[model samples]
Target: MSVKRLDWPDWLLSTLWLVVIAFIWWMAVRLLHIPEYILPSPEQIVERVSSSPTYFGAATAATLRVIAVGFMAGVAIAIPAGFAFARIQLLEKSLYPFVVFLQTMPLIAVTPVLIIWFGYGLVPTAILVGFSVLFPVLVNTVAAVKNISPRLYFVTSSMGANALQTFRYVDWPMALPYFLSSFRISLALATTTAVVGEFIAANAGLGYLALRGVRNKDPVQVISVVLIAALIGVLLNAASVLVETKVLRKYRD
Candidate 1:
């Protein structure tokens, strides 16, 4: 295939945007004469990250673990629950309201209750992350599955396909794109909730590091931790997008 050249690829444009933003940030700090402790220069944040790579890396790893577990747990439970909601009208009618309520509940207010119930630790944090991501996945999956054309189901039934076969051959492929989209959103939410979880209670992770930085009057550390969190969110979102593109490429046409 022959391709026409473009001004820039998306990745290049993204990088350029970051650079432009950084330049503006640097200019703001310099022009405004903002103190380092209040708003550390980009250079200072980088210096802080570089100076203590081991520390930040450890913290990031800890938080990453929480995110991973929570993501998996959320998907594991939500997908099945979604299927149930779609397959059983009574179940959906009976249970969906509470599920929606859970989704709408404010996490900040719920955090202390979770702490009291689950206690201060990784488990509560993981649960928080899982809870935070669950509703999106559930809602998306049910909607996707339920939104399929009735003709597809009739065709599968005419072919004498069993429930499992129908799901594999009809529902799975049709629903995957929506599922992946929701999955990406859930993952981003999971990362943020994981940080919030750590902030509420935890010995390690970026949130804890940020808290420590605050207590110790270390803006560089706080900003460095924020930088790491932002990087993780970006990378995760990118990975999700790549996976969706690869998996959904055939569906595009």
Candidate 2:
């Protein structure tokens, strides 16, 4: 018997949810009489964001470039390394501990070293983001590969599929969902890493803008930068979700 697919009107639901959030924000700003410095209203944030579109746009573009390059590089290295470790018991045994150690190492602790090593430009930011985002991809990919059913492997072997064929057809298909999930997580982590790198050492970007706001004691601008950063992160995550939905639709039934 064929399974009935559940049709979710995701777009409509998302729109409705956004509308509700906007309404709530509007009510809060209008009813609370909050100061702009302490808590800038939505209107204030929008105005600030709009005032210097060029500068904000350039900073956003810079941050996004770092995030994209770093996240792709991290995933590119991680997926292959994860597959190797999954198939090779000795390699898994040797590397798994180190991977765990790396995961536990705080990004804050190593930010200085990264800046020193890669310098105060895009390279350091990209490397920092990559380092921060790599663990999820690596761990999830390994788990996905290792968890493929032994029965399926045996059946494929009996059907004369070689190691390469088995990997292409069996392992990869099973791992695709997990990989996408990891990618979703890595995307967000990469963005945060980029911001952190910028915060530590940068001449421009949202984090630098935030630092300036702090030094100048402009709470409105501080909050504005934060909101913009959050919006950028949400947009990035939404894009990843769209990609995952399209790519993994086959597995969702």
Candidate 3:
């Protein structure tokens, strides 16, 4: 006889896992009698967040604003740069080393320069976020363009296609999937970098809140910020996947 399968929804499985983890955390805190300063219980974190929902909500919005500006700016620059790299050998050879060098430079170091140039507030932080979002998307975009079969280009050329037509019909469609796949990675980076920027120099955002919690020795506040950041990453990733699926389906059809 065959065993029956559960075939549960993906969200249900994820929820169950989250519940299990929370239960384990609760048990550990209770059994070990851990001090809240050292490690706040999950319940305590929830209580902290609930106590000042507006404060946390404003922090979330600020972080998201940075992430949005940075992520968009990064992708907007990276795609065209990738295309140019693929199309122009001289340009790529001349600039690719600099791009790689810039990537190697620690954001912590570069951020001060950005701060000096752009001043504080959103600009420097967003640029840091953009840096985090930039490299992966750029590399993927280049790979996507380069990986296209030479025969495909030949076919377009043989059909008397102009540069614009060739790109419209061949380059873009082939590269789109790679670009979308990179988007998921970039979104996650965007969140982390935004928080890091806040950590370095900002009065607001979850990173600032977390830093304050650290100085104040408030484990609950720090953990609450962490949970919120994780939630944002998950939601952004899910949204990217949904959009990718629909866009690919439409393109394929």
Candidate 4:
């Protein structure tokens, strides 16, 4: 029942790592006398971001909205479908290969067709994000649940547990670790793919901002956008860790 929070030592080490990386970046630029156009120092990036905070802020908000919608949609559809596949042998045999094939196709190639179908907006972009994240979660969850020993099923049934009770008592708890592992991988994919989706066609978002920066030949703006994108990815990863710790605390112990 104890609430889990990120501990101080972890924060200290993470901060120290960031400082070391900044120092290395600074030293490289200073020693090499690298031109700002080639690689701006960390200080320069900060200044650039500060100069146009409003633009970056709006773009970040747009991108985050896409990420959230895409991730939630992916989770809602993938988990139950994964369970159904694992529990039904015939369905798995027939459909799993099709799922694998869809997952293997490149998003770049798929994006144009999606735009044609869904039109150039958030619909196609969000669908791309969902598609990118769906497979890993489905694959891992089904694998974990299906691999549970048959003996466990016998024990659950002997205890008078029905199908739903068996899943509640045994199947879900055992498969949870694999489900969570897939989540970490898929969450990153969702956010990154969402950005790539935006690039395919969008009027707003960090992707759009980056493309504008490129066309205008402004490296500073591009670097600033890159930093913000990295920060968003880190934040999403931290959120995943928080959920994992809270949900799986007993299992961890």
Q: Report the C-alpha lDDT of model 1 over 1-253, residue by residue, as the tens digit.
A: 9998787887889889999998999999999999987898999888878898899999999999999998999999999999899989999999999998988988778878878887877888888899998999999989998999999999999999999999898989998987899988998899999997898867789999999999999998888888889889989999999999988996665
In model 3, state the lDDT of residue 251.
94
lDDT of each: 0.90, 0.83, 0.92, 0.85
Q: Ten consecutive residues with minimal summed lDDT in candidate 2?
A: 34-43
Tell me the lDDT of candidate 1.
Answer: 0.90
Q: List the residue pairs that clash in candidate 2.
A: none
Worst 10 residues of 3 by lDDT: 112-121
Model 2, span 1-253: residue lDDT tens: 9999977797677778878987898788779987666666777777887998997888888888888888888888899999999989999999889988988988778878877887776887888788878889999998999899999999999999999999888998899989989887888788778877788766677777787888998877787777777777778778889988987786656
- lDDT by residue for model 4 (16-127), tens: 9989999999999999999988888989989878887897899999898888888878878889889989989999999999999989989889888987788887777788
Best by lDDT: 3
Between candidates 1 and 3, which one is better according to TM-score? 3
Error of 2 at 124 (Å): 1.4
How do the predictions measure up, each by TM-score?
A: 0.93, 0.87, 0.96, 0.91
Clashes of each: 0, 0, 0, 0
Model 3, stretches more than 4 Å misplaced?
A: none
After superposition on all CA atoms, what RMSD does each candidate show versus the true structure?
2.7, 4.1, 1.2, 4.7
lDDT of 3 at 185: 96
The numbered model that scores best in TM-score is: 3
lDDT tens readout by residue for model 3, 1-253: 9999899988899889999999999999999999888888998988889999999999999999999999999999999999999889999999989889888888988877877788777889999989888899999999999999999999999999999999999999999999999999999999998998898767789999999988988888889999999999999999999999999999999
